[model samples]
Target: MDGPFATAFSLIASGDPALMQIIGLSLRVTLTAVLIACAVGLPLGAALALARFPGRGAVIVVFNALMGLPPVVAGLIVYLMLSRSGPLGSLALLFTPTAMIIAQTLLILPIVISLTRSVVEDLWAEYREQLLSLGAGRLRAVPTLLWDGRVSLLTGVLAGFGRASAEVGAVLIVGGNIAGHTRTMTTAITLETARGQLGLAVALGIILLTLTLTLNAVAWGAGQWARGRLG
Candidate 1:
């Protein structure tokens, strides 16, 4: 507890194996989750923006509502589904990194969908007439709208990544925080702090903050570069 800063810095400088493993696992899980979310959400969002279906307004409202879904609740849903008595429990995905990734994917999917839908919808409004005049149907128009709004969509992806990386409750519940396996930075920090291992917790916290800041900075820079190129 005493001189936690010094201890944290020392641990980082020394490259403690356990700390490094936690950091690695956290990155792997969050990045995987974000990628999966983007893959599913981006196209779905574009479809929602371009298609004129009945009950569309209600559907958008539901997705927007889901954007604020609690992490623990999402975790609970996943836990039950993966539990032995649950429908999907036969595969035994509970308490694994795969389960953690699934939980995070669910948690961030709404963020990606909502943000992407908003951006694509706005872009579609401006480009709809020109696209129609050019003989472009809904399917062809989706790529054009998506490409034109790439910067904003990228920001949405970054936002999803931020949410996925910072979350603890869902991952902790599904991952079981097992050392050298599913232990991520957020879970490790919680466990260490609870066990009065302030130095280790501080070290993990510093690393997590650094990773988050660096990711945002890179995303901002990429957005700027894209804007410049597209401008």
Candidate 2:
């Protein structure tokens, strides 16, 4: 434990308030984005899974392709949308936490939607027989299928959180990485690295990884408990 590693440990042990504030803001933005994405994606994906309409395949393909959308591009799009000349410019959401959240939400929305679509679609096929036999329409089956497949769906949710938490490009552009305001863990790491504060950057990275790991573990455990209870 020397060099940056030593400094990182010291930083963690010191419980720096600035570090804690950054971590808290990061969680707030990422969690809020993930929640919003799930709220929209889960039901939409499930609907897509059950609904058979014209060009549905194309729509799915579009979403699947969007999963690979570059973060910088997402940030650029958000920036343009929120810029003073753009349609939503009147809201003045640019360079703010809300803007950061919007950017991250766009980044991870595809992941949640695509993954949920896949999981729900598979579950739908297997349950089609019983559900139809029970006179359950596609719309009616959505809730039941979602409930039974909740554990699997948690993977998509976690994936969204992971992506949102790790991405810096989108948030940086829309957030402006403003100190004590829109700055997040990812942006902070970028800032520290740019400032040549390697030790601080490494410490921030470790803290971020720990936070992500802890959240993932808790979510996984909760999913496991739900699965057990459902069984």
Residue 193, candidate 2: alpha-carbon lDDT: 97
> Among all windows of ten consecutive residues in candidate 1, which has the lowest summed lDDT?
1-10
lDDT for 2 (candidate 2): 63
- Across 120-230, the per-residue lDDT of candidate 1 in tens digits comes to 999998999999999999999988888899999998999899989999999988888898999999998999999998877887788788899999999999999989998
Supply candidate 2's per-residue lDDT for 134.
99
Per-residue accuracy of model 2 over 7-50 as CA lDDT, tens digit each: 76787789888877898999999999999999999898999898
- Tell me the whole-model lDDT of each prediction, alpha carbons only: 0.90, 0.91
Clashes of each: 0, 0
Instruction: Give the Cα-based TM-score of candidate 2 against the true structure.
Output: 0.95
Where is model 2 more than 4 Å wrong at Cα?
A: 1-5
